[model samples]
Target: MDSSDTPSPIAEPLPYAEVTDPTYAEVAAQNFTVEEVAPDTHVLRGTCPRCNAVLEVPLVGNVFHGMRSIRDVLRKRHTKPSAGDRVEPVICTCEDAHPNRPEGRSGCGAYWTLLLTTEAK
Candidate 1:
């Protein structure tokens, strides 16, 4: 067929759906955790292993080498905290943390605690 006679391909638009608030399940699937460390301070933890940086919520302060999982503890890698850092336990959904999923999601729960630490000189 001649170039001029050839029909051009038509581009189709992607089907769109209205954006809605994500359900607790969806957010939970994303593994979002909220925990209170101290008065006015909170923690929002994620599943990313490299997310070792402990952030003090509401106050927006951060402390390196904060609490970590047993897996992280066994790894025993040295991490340093800057001038303003505090160590707080991770809030997670694990067998050690909660006996059962309080929200009705079979195995979901939160474990929040303070991290025992030896500060760097």
Candidate 2:
């Protein structure tokens, strides 16, 4: 117990940056996919392209969809997508940034991108 305990600290949540550095060798880059639930709702799931660990980001509840009609769609889902193209900002925020560094687990902070899809949608 210290004097600092009396003053609580408030800070931003984890996954601070929207996207991590791509050049870094250990940035835990991930491959993300967007799932359109309804018309304006979506869930972004990022999986390490070559490893285990999945991060799901939900874009809904009138935050990004602050104002949307029931008929709004993404026009076109990602077609012929590449990891480097459709994916940009990705980071590894798994398990409190992996302080303990679990074994066999890829808390390694590497980087990846979306899977390359070659199809006409």
Best by TM-score: 2
Query: Per-residue lDDT of 2-121 in model 1, one digit per residue for the tens?
Result: 999999996442222212232322332244444557754545544422222223233234343343332332222234533444444333332222232354332123334332232344
Off by over 4 Å in 2: 1-19, 23-30, 48-52, 61-93, 100-121
lDDT, candidate 2, 20-95, per-residue tens: 3433312222234456677647666655432345766555432323322211212222345343223333445455
TM-score for each of the candidates: 0.21, 0.32
The TM-score, computed over Cα atoms with residue i paired to residue i, of candidate 2 is 0.32
Q: Best lDDT goes to which candidate? A: 2
The true-versus-predicted C-alpha distance at residue 80 of model 2, in Å, is 20
Stretches of candidate 1 above 4 Å error?
A: 1-77, 93-121
RMSD of 1: 14.7
Clashing pairs in 2: 26-109, 28-109, 28-110, 29-110, 29-111, 29-112
Clashing pairs in model 1, backbone N/Cα/C closer than 3 A:
63-85
